[model samples]
Target chain A: MIDVVETTLTWRRLSPRMLVIHPFQEVVRAAPALLGLLVAGSSSGGQGHLWSVAGVALMVVLGMLRWFTTTYRITPEHVQVRRGLLTRKVVTVPRDRVRTVDVTSHVLHRVLGLARVEVGTGTSERRHEGRLKLDALTAAEAARLRVELLHRSPAAPATASTVSPTASPTVSPLAPPAGSTPAAETELARMRPEWVRFGPFTMSGLVTVGVVAGFVSRLVSEGNVDLGRVGPVQETWRWFSAMSLPLEIATVVLVLVVFVSVASTLGYVLAFGNFRLTRHAEGTLHVTRGLLTTRAITIEERRLRGVEVSEPLLLRAVRGARLSAVTTGLRAAQGSQRGGSLLLPPAPRAAAVSVARLVLPSVAGASSAWEASPVTADLTAHGPAALRRRFTRAYGVHALVLAALLALWWWAGLPSWTWLTAAALLPLTALLAADRYRSLGHALTSGYLVTRWGSLARRRVALECDGVIGWNIERSFFQRRARLATLTATTAAGKQGYQVRDVDLTEALRLAAAGTPGLLDPFLVEAQHVS
Target chain B: MDTPTLRSPQHRVSRTAVWYWAARAALGWLVLLAAQVAWLVADSDGSALPVTAHVAGLVVTAVVAVAHVTVMPQWRYRVHRWEATSAAVFTQSGWFKQEWRIAPVSRIQTVDSERGPLEQIFRLANVTVTTASAAGPIKVSGLDRDTAQRLVAELTATAQATAGDAT
Candidate 1:
């Protein structure tokens, strides 16, 4: 017979510290009534203290109710949590299915010695939506729970002599024997890293953001301007006259440069504040960092889906790359509605490869294969054919549209220069169309499908053929006439649809058949017979 | 390989499908005509309506409605039964253009039921079956409350049984 503990545990057992959201979040919640009181008091010119006092009292009461209403429970078999004051929610998750547990502490939570733990179970159901705010567990407690939850096996002995002295009987019913090798401890020891940091935040980046924010806010609040109004126009004209034309152009360029620099710098800082990544001896990747809010994420090697390495054009010069792992379940920290993309950005290509190998043993040699024959052939031939087709297609409609518009303007007695402007648009459109065409390419082998595309920013996505869950080939009436087909490949990470438009029918079929071995023939027949 | 074990047969949908088809047909034609008129108005010059564009839009809309009327319900009523020894689920919707899905008893990640105002009036509930993969979340609607409850219970039982076998 099993005895259930009916008493609810306090949030302290989950984590001893308070939440680390923006200080202004609490203030914002309390502000409306306080502001209303102040406005009313100021209008009346005196005697507002009572109203202010009442407002503060109401805020305090609401805050306490909010805190007390949210509670979480952990059991030997499962974890149960209940929250929300009005529309009550009860979430129950079995320990066996829980895949990943992430703990995060914002600056406030860090100060209060509290943290929020998020648990993600790899299930598509609504009830299996990742749990947020499993709050206030100590680092050690959170780690222990995470390890036990992730590694729990029904086949393990029901009773063993090797149970840890510190293990809670309620949480761990059938502990492993003392002398037996502990898999969890070994994994923990292997994956933890030492330190992580962002690129230096230059001073100029901050000023640019402030300026841009100010400019945008001003534009939004002011609405449309009246050029007829002499006062505002005169002020603008005065400022315009103060700067030289060259200086004005230079300033605009400088502002744009500063804007991008600042944004990227800030992104780096926010993402990697005091970051410490460690590989636990047990083969788990343990990442802990944050200046204001500390976060720890553990990625088990077995659960890793794939490794993605990306290199932007700018980064290619320095051989800088970003690495991210695709894994089962959500890995977002607590109090964060959005999840990180498992990225390690701006590292050397070698470092990226090393990280990929460490996390995904299967993908170890996959990066080297990136430079192999098929990839090179696919990349070089992909763009030129696409560009040729784009030029041909655009010439039929886009050039005609421009010519007609120019003719209309010329007949309307507009300046001949306007016709020149219209004619110029044709060449520009053709150039853009060609560039777009040149960026598309695809290659497929038995094990993988590699797609490379992009004009300004290049992207190469490599997907394992066996991992492809769904595929489709679509052809419109126009595409049928043109002998082209579009193929879409869907994996666990949303849908990636690629078009091999304007390819010979035979080639298209062959390519489709190669990427999705059993699916293409039926899909092609269905598509061809659709009309 | 040995023959796969098959689960029990799924309950069929009640025969209120004709009304559903009529409702869909009316909405589809109305929306199609409205969209055609909107496009014509937006693209028209300030002068008289472009005769070619106007006629083309009307013809396209009519053709689309004709296609929808033929395709909609045939696909909706076509039902299929999918069952494996450890998992069982039923998929029914349309004949030609259909939604064919299967969830094994062991693969069921979550079970949920919802009832709208119309469903409440008709005492019908829709049950959604979720799986480990995010792509497919099967929704079987127009089931009576008793039927929906029984289906849920059956699925839960099979899921538990399969889980037990695996362990």
Candidate 2:
């Protein structure tokens, strides 16, 4: 291994493959425009080729210019990036302030043996502050930079501080060079092909299928496909009309269910394929997953506050639950739908809980000094008044809708069976309301305040009491009448606020006081007096 | 909940808030009256609409204006309360829908006070306590100038001492 540790504020360029990638991305960006050009050409008898050629040439030039202008430099103190040709811009993130360094390689990047590096500094990512993204870096260099930036061991920091030219490249900060491994390393979770069965139950599959169908139909229509015969909408409508009304609905639902299941299974396999979670001797948990866009997330143990295990209605029916890390650093990474908080994919509730226990030492189950008795059946439910309120609210809403339907029938001469159909759904709504009311509960343990809420996707979060920074109590007109308040525990970690919904006024105050002893005591007195 | 010792009754905002609210209500009423007048003028072509529509609209507007000017101010005053200790800032505000919040000193990321033209006329200001919570900021408005300044000073001092201590 070469010990060529040159430290002279040397600027680095991204992988040369970015030249290819930049143009490819430009092409992707202009695909719709190009298609429009082609359509225009078809209409105007091949005159659109000139515009298409001009557009492609312009995009290629812009891409090349952008690639040439952007460059990043790694200093001992900060990782600085400079870009923009017209207006020069510079951004830097301090080395020690960097909380997480992620290396992700999408299909294209992977194919080119390149990866995108993201450096997070544990600050709110508003306007892209406290973050840096370097695209199209060689996979090896990305890994090296990740280690170099995160390296805080005595040997590396000392050498780095001195700008020592002889700092060995052989020593890896996180991993012990190629052949050997750390003794304390333990595999916490790994993907199992069979676990894909739980994926379809998430109902996320159905949503994705719908999205894809929408996109495809739009694409086909854009391509000038004959919508009258080729469109799935007309075909489905025709088929449904041929069958009995109920039978048609059932068959359509069944088809949708089948499509969703297939899609979900495939998605689960692709996303969680080769998934691995390991705890290292350094007290950092490393997660690596994805078949097409491989991603690696590193979570420091100290930053982990707790865990949130979510059980959606379908997932709960199959006794499956997903676990997420309640941590500070990963919040910025949780962009779009794929939350970076996910600690485990949808798995058995027991397994998820066990993994959660391992991740957050004292905040998962009943095996710690803090949570002597985990919040289970004995959780303090928001009393009978809450139940009544839920029922009244649910039934009131339903009645209003029914009345609207009746008004439409009377005034607009609508069908009468609509009222009956709506009436038939009342009991189901009532049952759900009852279930939601039943699900509302809160408990204050020795060091954590556990709140359980929701019916469809019930979540029981055991937030560390010390993590709670403030309390927000809200009582609407109806709730004030019912002597109820929604108590939200505000914390810097996790979801920012966890609410104990529809709790008794006194009980909510008590919980608030218990969670942060002195902070809410003054408010509690006034509240208690009023009550 | 273990009740804290009663240091003093929760401090109410400046009494001038009533006039402030009344003035705002007057502005709203003026807007409503203008809209009604505009509707009447636009419908002067009056093919079939009755004179009763204008009479009823004017009556409802008068009633709403009266309630907003007379009733809302008193309700708001009664509900608005705020107290700042070394540990935290406790505030209870909102008239019909009561909201009580306790923002700990350590958690306060920023302490700011705002005064608009109307508030300036009343010599009153609104103190906003922002924390790193997604539920938004805790606001204590309608404070006398002196009290607002003192509150901001006290909060800023304590917040500084507890900076970076928030969990």
Candidate 3:
């Protein structure tokens, strides 16, 4: 156990090594600019060198000054961080409000045995004022600070109620502060090398390959390398020019497949290498992963509301799924589809579910509302009108595209085969539309509202009803014509809007009314006779 | 099925809301017109566009400005409805695509009343109710100044009272 000073009031500076580390980080950040200067100087004769030197010097001074001035203190009531010379700002987060203590160590920091710690105050707004970050600290000290900040007494009435009562049996022996014993820690999941097989199944492989190839080509071009002179390029180009059209296309595709597979395998290794999830006695789930720059994310057990299992179309073919925690206080990027809630990388369906159960016990336990196996979960399908709408909308969009393509073919003489291709894709679109309708289902389990939707990348989330704070009902004129409405149950956890789409308006009203009983009663028109 | 009535029917905003929206639309048109005038003047001095092209552009702009100044305010007035109870605030807005939002008092983080220069001249105010939900704040515009102030006060009081442990 690392020795920890228990003083609460005194302000503290991070390890002095931070001064060196911060300046080093600044230099590393300035490397690209320095490289650009070098390139320019070589091209234009020495003017850029002076600017590069000045920029590096200024960054070093600023980094040193920042390190020297910044100080933080964990008082009994709040965690206060005071810094900035010219701006001079103070950020204070109440102790109870601190939700997550994320520790990350870059390759450099790891070599120096230091980690960066960020204390989040649980506010989802991207305001720096609500967060406290310590740029560098010993790995042990980071662990201890995480434990100290997250440690809540089991006897505390407020938090105890949130934790499963059965967990109390294991609580007594684990009461000592973290870093005290390894015996109470339980390893929940670890990365399996075989899971890399699912990496290519995700569309990310092709995207990653394309990105890397583009970047490499750009770099090569900048360095005055003739791409056509490259061995594979020259050979392929010569062969392609000589070959039949179909064979040429096949060869190109084969090369792409090979590149994508290799990139996917590499990406999986970089992301999930040595991935480990463990539950501390203090009820914080620590997830550590990554090969190059290891990241350690701490999630308080109580803040967890539920779990989501997503299976993309390609991944689903092989029974692979990814798990994400639907919890409060987790950072969600503005307008982005994915949040910082990934619990398990794409893996075998069984493995993902097993890990989800371990991380979130309530998801599968006897007292659970949702099923242990989401596959077996009896979800209620929406009305047939919803299916009709999906098909009509899907086909309508495809028809519009086809019409535009036809018009282009008539006006500008586009390839007639392109029209044939578009025509052939209609069946696939119809199949997808049918699958989307089949995927749309919602259920009010004992304590959770489980909604499943999407065709390309389907997500089935079982969000705890208790976590719901509000209910929104929307009916567009088109939806009204179909007597349908979208009901979104707004919860602090997970995506802000989780919709039970294209349900009968009355059904939506009833669901909203039932989710939060008295809250919506005032707004809902009662039936003439109480059923 | 028989048409169902909303148990707590929403209240339409003040009629002055039309004037407020019309003024805002006019202001937007004014800015666009200023830019177009500047562009037309610059084009005339040097690379003058065809007479027909300029006439067509001006005609489209005028038609759009007229439609916006006349039709939009009415549509907005018809679509926008809000209801506040002790438990939640329900706001329904948008014309072409209606949006319905509900924010529970328990999740209320802040309540603010804003009055722009145009709104001030029209004696109208907008009350914004912010929640932790990422859908962003709910703006109930076109309230009488006194009503906006009172609603803000009432919402603040309710928020304080019902503020339990929430993110």
Candidate 4:
């Protein structure tokens, strides 16, 4: 382990065409600022052209420098990349440590027949730190490198004895020629045109609009762009001012619904347009998706620990669900279904369940029904105590708010209708509490320890028993008073720890001991029954 | 279900752990009290309105700090326990909100011992063990320095003897 070799290794440069691609990308990145500058200059009669020209020139130069300074090489034993011209940084990862290889191509790259290859090492604490990137390569070379990195063959001998100056793609007989004999692929799920109906339930349109609006508003605020002076803005304001009070509210709501639906529909089509989940003969799951930026990610089935069935409140209402694989070393991109973990998009709950069963053989069961599938199997209820606690917590907040609202109405000059409105909404809160109680469940079936919890964004994780490394039994002050505890099964898969919240203390201990037999036995003191 | 319960781990951290907790709590309270005193002194404009209020605030803080420094240490000392066997490392810690963590010997990736300035002043140490998960590491806090060292060595040796990848 203390051995260090001082031999020089070969390095290769990125495709020269990427230099052109980089400048365009940089220009797009700076478009917001450029728009702001243009607006400011237009308001002040002129002055932004010089700055814009200089900025573009600087960006072009910076983009070209990447092709000059960045170089990477894949040896038989290690994959190395050296980046930067002024302050040199060289990152080398052992060949076997390569977990996932992603080949992504945007519209420009696809047009240029160039692709970007990112090696996911998943070893370092920071996600990006563990990644080694090759800015642009021929689509063929990118595919070859993907095979070369993950195929784990040592047939290439040039890396061992010869210090080659460039990546000799012809010499790498180690990787069975990529795209030669297409491996058998088992297609699990394909995008359906009708699945677009579940788009508005995801609320991604609202999030996208919020993000874009916030960014544009920030830029507009910094500039002199009078949004009210814009033709559409002026017309909209005039139209709004021309309406009666109730009509205006109804119109605003109707317009918002239409806008959100259209935006989310567009987003959904763009994201999952050509979504395909396929299993390869080499024991890897291939996920290829996206519209403008085509992404292809490979996940090793052996690294997969389990699967998670996710259902947000609105999606659940529409009987739509999402399926994500719980795997080690795969990036979990939060709040987006654009990662290696997503197995199915927002589709029919039955489709999501069937896809989950197909993806993970551990969930093989008889029924194809959404509820009967092991992914959504019946769970043990936490009994009336847990139910009571949920109600108390729900009504507890409502009671406090009602007291405050009534106090405000009595002491201050507030209207009484506020408290009355809150009282009228009491039934909604009870429904929510009941839904939360219904969602809280845990079970052990086959080799999977299943735990499901949460209200708004309910997720049911089915983790393999062998993947559990440790257990955390915690009793908060209130939980202790309720004679309940939260048992967290710690694993290296998605989320790291999945908790069976608010369970009877003894039952929790039993669950822990049963999940991974010998792990918790030493800590448990058996209460012998006199049967 | 037999309704089994957890038995507290076999070893209390150390007798000096009480002093360590007390000293740490007292240090935090001292900083709080010092900041409040400085604020009171700086904000006063020879006015009686806020002087009395600040003084009352000082009294309340002092009362809470005294109770925390006195009762919390003893409670923590009683709560903190640890044990290590060939199979696993177990610990029970915290006062009002207690936690029991158990990590199998084979799954432990690394074992480390640390002594902060406060721990050093109290002649105490902490031994931390971790696996590949981002969940909280198992820790044995306020141990005697030599005991922490031995614990680290024992855990490291046990981990070396096992063959799992720790993931």
The lDDT per prediction is 0.53, 0.74, 0.75, 0.81
Q: After superposition, how far is residue B68 of candidate 3 from its true place, in Å?
A: 4.1
Residue A42, model 2: Cα distance from true site in angstroms: 1.1
lDDT tens readout by residue for model 4, A445-472: 7667888987899989888888888999
On lDDT, the leading prediction is: 4
| Of candidates 2 and 1, the better by TM-score | 2
Q: Provide the RMSD of all predictions against the true structure, rounded to 1 decimal.
A: 9.3, 4.3, 5.5, 5.1
- A1-531: candidate 3 lDDT, tens digit per residue: 111224445677877777778778777666555544544445653554566568788978988888778888776567788899899898888778877777888888888888988876556344545667888778877876777678665554344435544433322212344546688688888899899898777666787876667655544433434567779989977867998889888988998888877778787788778988888877878788889878877788888877888999988999999888777766543332133467888889988878876775463334543363433378888889899999999999999989989999999899998888999999999899999999999877655677899999998887777777777777777887787888888776666668899987777776776667777666666456321
Mind giving the per-residue lDDT tens digits that candidate 2 earns over A1-531? 123244315778878898898778777765654564555446643544566568788888887887788888776577898888899888887666666667788888999999988775544433345468888699988877765665444554444435544554333333333114556568899877778879888777877887767655644544454456657879877877899978987997998999888888777877778988888665667778889988877666666766787889999989998887776556622563155667888888877877866676554434564236343325887889999988998899999999999999999888999988998999899898998888788888646788887889888887778677788888998998898888888766667778888998778877877777766555443424543
- The C-alpha interface RMSD of every prediction is 11.6, 4.5, 3.5, 2.2
Return the TM-score for each candidate structure: 0.62, 0.86, 0.85, 0.88
Question: Which rank order by DockQ, best down to worst?
Answer: 4, 3, 2, 1
Per-residue lDDT over B59-128 for candidate 3, one digit per residue giving the tens place of the 0 to 100 score = 7998999998999899989878888888788888877566677778888988999999999899999999
Question: What lDDT does candidate 2 reach at residue A452?
Answer: 84
Model 3 off-target regions past 4 Å? A1-8, A18-61, A124-128, A155-180, A206-248, A332-339, A361-376, A399-424, A527-531, B1-5, B8-10, B29-61
Best by TM-score: 4
Per-prediction share of native contacts kept: 0.03, 0.51, 0.51, 0.81
Q: Between candidates 3 and 4, which one is better according to lDDT?
A: 4
Give the DockQ of candidate 3: 0.46
lDDT (C-alpha) at residue B160 in model 2? 91
Better of 3 and 4 by TM-score: 4
Judged by whole-model lDDT over C-alpha atoms, candidate 1 comes out at 0.53
